[model samples]
Target: MSKEYLDGIIRRSLEIRNKYHELERLHHGSEWTVEEDALAYLTDAGLVGRNIMSQQQRWPKAGSQTELEHKLGENIWWLIVLAKRSGIDIKDAVNNFLTETEAILK
Candidate 1:
């Protein structure tokens, strides 16, 4: 995708995150800590695994594909948010990962 498209996606993701932070501040008197975000991300990551198990018929869940799709997207969002919180440039990080991995594979 074009950088412009990716920027739009990131903008939307951050906007959603801002709303969640606002809600958290109202409920908890503070935004969630980075550790809390990490925990939430891990929870979703576990659900992703569960969905994979269901997809493979190893789990008894009735709906896996849709939830899997959602979790996968949610994971990406979490990564983006985590990177922002940690002062990383997400686009550069992704680019470096892909480039280095592809070079190593080749």
Candidate 2:
């Protein structure tokens, strides 16, 4: 897919996840907790980590590209949800840590 199309999907995903967070805040679900959303995010994180290692041929496990891509996409979607929940811009948060690392290590 083209970068433009990908950006549209990213923005759309964020919009949907943000709405989910709002619903969560209102306790719209039967349960009073947003544990489901949190779980989905964590699961995606683990899968994506595995996918990265697999891509690098360091996983020492079995998996196909199609599955890996899905995991990676899911991970990205969840990361955006996490950022939204924390009131953080994903790009800004990464840049801040990268910028501070030099001083911290020096």
Candidate 3:
């Protein structure tokens, strides 16, 4: 996907996470729903389901596909938060790793 789209997904990831935190505060972490639980731990069924269906002829249900994409962004958001918290710069890391990997391959 395009960087712009990726940025938007990343934005959404943080947004949902912030909402979850708010819910926890409002309910003392006792009033969340099952769906919320899905987002809480990044239990992205869509991604997993896709893998299951990949080898099959038919596609996964549309709704399941949507959930997968949503979860993908949310998971990435979590990664962004963790990296920021740990002062890990993924961009630089990716560049350094790419060079090392390429050298090894060559």
**Cα lDDT listed for each candidate:** 0.95, 0.73, 0.61
Q: Please give, for residues 1-106, the per-residue lDDT of candidate 3 as tens digits.
A: 7778766765665577678779887979564554555465455444655644643526745565556566665556666655444577655655799999999999
The per-residue C-alpha lDDT of model 3 at residue 54 equals 44
TM-score of each: 0.95, 0.57, 0.49
Residues 1-106, model 2: lDDT tens digits: 6658756876988788767667776775443234576788788778778877877898876764677898877777877666766678866776799989977998
Worst lDDT 10-window in candidate 3? 51-60
Model 1 residue runs over 4 Å out of place are none
lDDT by residue for model 1 (1-106), tens: 9999999888888899999999999999999999999999999999999999999999999979999999999999999899899899999999999999999999
Q: Give me the overall lDDT of model 3.
A: 0.61
Full candidate order by lDDT, most accurate first: 1, 2, 3
TM-score-sorted candidate list, best first: 1, 2, 3
- Give every collision pair in model 3: none
